[model samples]
Target: MEFDYIIIGAGSAGCVLANRLSADPHISVCLLEAGPEDTSPLIHTPVGVAAILPTRHVNWAFNTTEQRGLNNKLGYQPRGKTLGGSSSINGMIYIRGHRTDYDDWKALGNTEWGYEEVLPYFRKSESYYGGTNQYHGTEGELFVSRLQLHGVTKDFIEAGISAGHSHNADFNGEEQEGVGAYDVTIHKGKRWSTASAFLKPIREQRSNLKVITGALAERIILDGKKAVGVSIRQKGKSRQLKARKEVLLSAGAFGSPHLLMLSGIGPAEELAPQGIAVLHELPGVGQHLQDHPDVVISYRSPDTSLLGVSVSGSAKIGATLWQYLRHKTGSYASNCAEGGAFLKTDPNLDRPDIQLHSVIALLDDHNRKLHWGHGFSCHICVLRPKSVGSVGLTSSDPAVAPKIDPNLLGQEEDLQTLLKGYRMALEIIKQAPMAKYQLQDIYSADALTDEQLSEVIRARADSIYHPVGTCKMGRDENAVVDSHLKVHGIDNLRVVDASVMPTLVGGNTNAGTIMIAERAAEWIMQDQATA
Candidate 1:
């Protein structure tokens, strides 16, 4: 059956597209999600992000094949497989990233994506509890609220301030630099993902919007050079759904570009070797992979930190359960990542070279295996990494995960920046207010000198969970899509997710991804009107 629009992958962008596009009663929209419905209780609780990470219920637990940069250790990369995508299971920090990040997008030939032009779209998608202002809008769907910090978390924030960094209450407000507790995509202590904010309210109201869960799209169906429809696998049966107007790909950084290549629209040289016939030799479909790599600096605390207490004993579990029953507040309510900072690793750098995520717990290896006992830790990540990477097909089969080579720590300067960030984190732990906790360096800072620490930084650094630019947007020869997120050679198709980002944002990628979707929805609707 043909529809006005067929949006693929019901993630952050796809949910917004369904809500906005289906607003017109006359236009019919079909939204497809590869995973199941987002019914898990863990999804609503902001703190439940940890419990769902290892499971495949709403997660695509993808791992990289032994990164040479990280001493050949394979890093785990998790993406959301539910209706809300990664938004369903992610650290709920509500960061829009630096304004300069967006300005850089305009500089890269995407004129319609300047900071000034994109600000309205950011505002249009937010319902900030901090109130309406020039920088924020309170009348939108997604919830943005002030963080409810615990006693230990409060101490960590002061520790950052006592170390010479000023406290900036709101990262999304006036300035982004400095250490402070972060605002999150939570409201009154509950998670407010795109499913909660955008989809729930309009799901029943919009009969024109048909949502299909557990429908995995194999590839785009092409008629000549244009994307006519999508071929999907549902209940072990292959079905074809046509898009009368357009087939919008909002499958995110990994999925969108993979689908593009699967449909025979990627680089000819790369595709021909795999025995896949190239319908279009668009060289940049699955290139330009970018992510923020984080290194941890751990410290043993005076008392059992939030991290220790959460995993301790039956008493701790009982107390948290009682607290949650009584007031919907306690250990369970806090997203482990309580505070963070945007700082410059070197004073001479153009902007903040590193971003810090101060977690109330101690984690090692991205918290999958090996956690520290009764300790606190800080994650120092190199924002705007100089390192570049790529995503490519591992096999001809569409079911196989793509080979993701982030090429982390490839540059000498990247190793230096991370080491500097580690040193800065240690300096913060030594400050007076923070020192009251009597923090002990469990990671053994004294054991490693400056030179050795750089080695450790390169060996242990992992992604801060922000991945973008697989399908970069620009006008260059290597560009996959144009400024409007439309594929350069294909008509009536658009890639409107984080895949369209020419580079990763300065901070968390969620807010920027949502903003892109919001703006893209406007562009699509406007184009439809003109057509």
Candidate 2:
């Protein structure tokens, strides 16, 4: 089979690309996904993320190499494997990140990626429930709305305000500092994944677009330095699909770099060891990895309104389930991490360097650890960690998982920043609004010194699930893609996903990734007109 464009992953970015590129009836596009269709009941239910996240139901469930920073413990990375990708399984918090995040990208030589140039693309992909404004779009495919607040979530926000942080109604608005409820991607009580927002509505209508699930991509078929097609194994059968014009890789940060190395388009030294011949020696294929290293400060609260395991809690959930089935309201309609804040660790910093997530349940070790009763937890993370890591091949075969090493807290500054953030989180929880519930600290003691807190950070901190910049875009030798998202030193190939980010954004990456695809699709269409 041949197509004008072959998209390697039917993820958040790929779905948007499929929708926009195929909108032109004359253009034929093919999207390949390693996972199954987004059909699970858990995927559609907003609160079902609790069940889906801790297990491999629809997740990649990739584990990182033992991190020396975290006392040599392996970190869990649960990426969504369905059509919508991570967006299908994520917390659903909609954040475009601090504006300066994009400004920093432009300063790093990606001239067209400044915040002002990219804001329109962000607006173009959103249908804000708050109606159209300078910061939001009202007529886009994806829906964005405020989370249905629980009493505890309201208290968390109040506590933040009482703790000296101003209340920010919109984190994606004029400024990204202070505490508030997050705008989520949930709509009509369902998880509004990219597949739901972009692909499903148009799938039956577009005959020019072909979407294939359960297809594992093996390698890019290269004609010298140009990518011509992809070799994939689907249903135990080998097949080769050619691309008439371009092959776009939206396989995400890990998959994109891993596939490039398997296809011999990465660092020669790394490929030679894996028994793969070098096709293109791009040393930065899997370098500059970044993730938000987080620590959860949990407390056992007397508040039974929060989600947890107990007779009353279970009964509440049962009732909530019934309510959801009937009217799509109540706790079942909530995304677990409902309220959040972006704050500065140091008052001197230009922007907030730390982010907070207030969960309505005791979330320990990504919810893999079970607590007996009701509780509340606050997740604090260094928004822009100075530490960097890499993603490398564990085996030459595509069936093997990549050796992920986020190297969380590998830098001293990150650890110091986290320590301060930890104190801040504790102070907020102890504020009058939250203290009225009489929550007991379950993770740490008040007597623990800064040094003790640093040790705790080193032991408990792990990724908040945002990993990016492995295939960064820049003009430097380390760059894998150019400003137009086309792979450098290679023709007819482009990487349009989070992997192309030159630096990690300051907040949730889903919104930023969709914006990238919106921009990329427009550029591709413009190029097609000239071609």
Candidate 3:
């Protein structure tokens, strides 16, 4: 079947595109997801993050190259493979990043992408719990609500205030550089995934919309640089689906560039090794990789308030599961990293350079390893790190995972910033509110020297799950996508996902990506009218 538009990867950006573009009823839209449909009950439950994260069930679970910067340790990247994309399995934190990040995009030659222009889209795509306001929208496709703040979370906030940081009620509000509770993409104690908010509701109603699961988009069928269709694989069979008007590449940072390279749209150097013919050589297809590199400061506490599996804790989980089944409220409704803070490492910096997440459990190594007893952890991430990495093709085969080298901590300043934030986290723990519950420093000793801190930072540092900029949008020669998200050297094709971020935003990528799709949908419809 021919479609007016074919969207690859039904992720955070793709689902929004499907909803907006197909709402016309006349335009046929086909959304191809490489993974399964978002059907597992664990996806809806907010607490199911534990179940989905550590496994490949609904996660891509990609790993990075051994970082020379991190003592040759490999970093883990868990991307969502299901319909909602990473938004389904993520921590559900709603952060649009600081306004300066978008302004920087505009400054770097991307028109119509400044904070002032993008604010409307962020507002348009949100259903804020605080109702309609200047910064947030009330009636929208996505739901953003308050976290069920645990006593430990409250103590963490009080400790932040005691540490001389302003107490911010809403991190999405006017000021961003402060400590506060983060708003989440949760509705009635369930994760409000993009599939839930946009696609699922209207799937059966819209006859023009087609969603195919278990389909891998191998490559774009390019006819002299014009993307007309896609070659997809499913159930050990190959099929070709054509797009009559345009093809939207919403396959995300790693997948978007991987598809481009596989379709012969990337650097000739990368394709030559993979033995793929060069179709459209855009040297910037898989360069400029950026992400938030982070480390954790953990403390062993007998805090029964947090999630832990002991004889008594296991019993509580049983009772909590029953409570969650009946009313969707209990310990089972947590997104784990509920409370967070965005702070400026340097006072005069325009925006926050460091972000901290207070996890209710001992989350280390993406929780792939289990630790005994009850404890809490604080994560410090270097937002907008100067260090950059790349995604490259490892083989000619489409099914082969791309080589992801984050080159983590390539910049000494990034490590320095993380060290500063690390020290700040230790101070927060020492404050009055959480002092009673704190037992001992589970990860490091007290008053360690700079060398000691540096060693620990490298050993523990990993991706905070925000990878972007492989197909960055800008007007420069290195840019893969133009201001309107259209591929620079390709026709009838556009990239609409985290890969197009010109620079890493100050916070999470979910809200920023959804806003990008919201704006891209308008652009597509406007182009449709003119065409």
Candidate 4:
């Protein structure tokens, strides 16, 4: 098969890219996804995230290398392996990070990525249900709305305010510091993934677009210095698809870097040891890994209103499910993590360095561990960590999982920040509104000393599902992609995904990832126009 563009990984970015690039009738675009189509009913239900997160069903349940920082525990990395990618299986919270995140990118020589310049792209991908404003859009494909506030979620917000934090209705608004309900990517009663937002509406109408699922991209087919096609394996058969214009990698942070290395375009030493010939010597193919190291503080709540596996909880869910099926409202339509906050560890910091998620469930170890009764949990993560890690080849085979080492909490500063955030979470729980719901403390106490609390943090803290910077975009020596998202020393190849983020954003990365694709699609179109 041949096309003008071949986009690998039909994830958050690829969906948007396919929609925008295929808009012109003159060009053809083929999108390759390693996973199956998003046909599962669980994918569209807002509460189905609980069932999807801990299993391998439509999820690339990858595991990180044992980190010495976490006492040699292998952390779990769950990525979406279906059409919409992580957006189909994520928490569905809509966050754009801090404005300074983009400004910092501009400072790093990416002049087009500054806050003022990228805001339009951010607005372009969102159809804010709250109506359009200076910072939001009302006509975009992706739906952003406020979920019906749960009683516990409202109480959590009240507790935050009582704890001296300000109440923010929109974290993506004038400021990102405050405790409030989050804006989620939900429409009506369903989880509005990129597939539903961007691809679904245009899939049947666009004859030039071809979406191939269950296609594992083995490597990019390079003709000398230029990328011309992709070799893929599907249904026990190997085939090659040609790209007449460009090959865009939107396989996300881990998959993009892994594919680049598998295609002999990464560090020489790493590929050579894996028996892969190096076609290009890009030392930064998978360096500078960053993620939000999160620690959850949970409590056993007698409030049957919260989600759990107990009898009453199950009964409540059954009723809510019926309500959702009928009216598209109720607790079943919740994202679970209905409320959150962004705050600074140090009061004098210019922006929030820590983020909080108030989950209406007893979430332990990414829901890998379950409890009997109803409860509430709060997740605290350092927005930016000083520690950096890398992604490397485990083998030359594309099917083999990459060696992911986030090196979370490898730096003392990260641990300190998490410790402070943990303390802040405890303080909020102590407020009357939240304290009333606490039946028993399931994690730690406020009286724990700094040393004791640090140990607790080190033992429990892991990723909050935000990972970026493996294939960072910049003009620095380690940059894999330039400001236009084109590979530094490659032709007709660009990576449009979270992997190109020069730095980790201050919040959830879904909104930012979609914005990146919107901006890249415009540039790609502009280049095509000139060509």
What C-alpha lDDT, on a 0 to 100 scale, does residue 171 get in candidate 3? 79
For residues 331-403, write the lDDT of model 1, one tens digit per residue.
6777888888899876786767788887776666666654445567788888888888888887766677878
Give the winner by TM-score: 1 or 3.
3
Instruction: Show model 3 residue runs off by greater than 4 Å.
Output: none
Segments in model 2 whose C-alpha atoms lie over 4 Å from true places: none
lDDT accuracy of residue 470 in candidate 2: 91
Model 4 agreement with the true structure over 307-339: per-residue lDDT tens digits:
887876777878888999999898778999999
lDDT of each: 0.84, 0.93, 0.91, 0.93
RMSD (Å) per prediction = 1.7, 0.9, 0.9, 0.9
The list of candidate 4 runs beyond 4 A from truth reads none
Please give the lDDT score at residue 3 for candidate 2: 95
Q: Any runs in candidate 1 off by more than 4 Å, and if so which?
A: 309-313, 370-372
Model 4 TM-score is 0.99
lDDT of 2 by residue, 1-531 (tens): 999999999999999999999999999999999999999999999999999989999899999999988999999899989899999999999999999999999999999999999999989999999988899998899999997798888988998999999999999999999999999999999999999999999999999999999999999999999999999999988899999999999999999999999999998878999999998899999998999999998778667787888877777878888999999988889998999899998899999999999998888888899889888889999999999999999898898999999999888899999999999998888888887667887758754888878887788889989999999999998899999999999999999999999998999999999999999999999999999
Model 3, C-alpha of 265: deviation from truth (Å): 0.3
